[model samples]
Target: MAWTWTYETADGRETGRSAEFETRSDAESWVGEAFGELLEQGVDQVRLFDGSDEVYGPMSLHPA
Candidate 1:
């Protein structure tokens, strides 16, 4: 299944997408590498998906 990450703002507005991946691990790894810069650009949360199915998260990028 193709995996992707949706980047969003704190209020749930979608801001962008990560490059598509063939596996979830690659998708998550891409997020790990770029999440800091994404947060700096005002991405407040992220969600992972396999096609239209959400795997998890609207997870906060900010430290709690």
Candidate 2:
């Protein structure tokens, strides 16, 4: 299954999506590297998916 990410706003509006990845680890790594840029683009949070199944997240870009 392809792994992917959906970028969202603080209010839960989806604003963007990521390129499909071959593995969940790759998807997570990509998000780890890109979250800063995503925040600059107005994405406050992100969700990970394994095809149609949600793996995790609504993870915030801000440090907590």
Candidate 3:
């Protein structure tokens, strides 16, 4: 199945998604490289998904 990432604001609003990937690894790598920029752009958290099913996250960019 294809994989992707959905963004969320610090206040908990769901934003848009990144481009889809052929593998989960590709998707996670993209997030690894780009999450810092996403944080600067106001995305506070992110979730990885396989199709519409969430595999994990709502992971905060901030330290807890």
Candidate 1 C-alpha error for residue 43, in Å:
0.5
lDDT of each: 0.91, 0.91, 0.89
Ranking by TM-score: 2, 1, 3
Positional deviation of residue 27's Cα in model 1 after best superposition, in angstroms: 0.9
Per-residue C-alpha lDDT of model 3 across residues 1-64, encoded as one tens digit per residue: 8898889987778988899999998998899899889988889999899999999988887768
RMSD of 1: 0.9
Clashing pairs for model 3 are none
Candidate 2: which stretches are off by over 4 Å?
none
Better of 1 and 3 by TM-score: 1
TM-score of each: 0.91, 0.95, 0.89
Clashing residue pairs in candidate 2, if any?
none
Model 1 Cα lDDT, one tens digit per residue, 1-64: 7899899999999999888899998988888888889988999999999998999999888889
Positional deviation of 23 in candidate 3, in angstroms? Answer: 0.8
Q: Candidate 2 overall Cα lDDT vs. reference?
A: 0.91
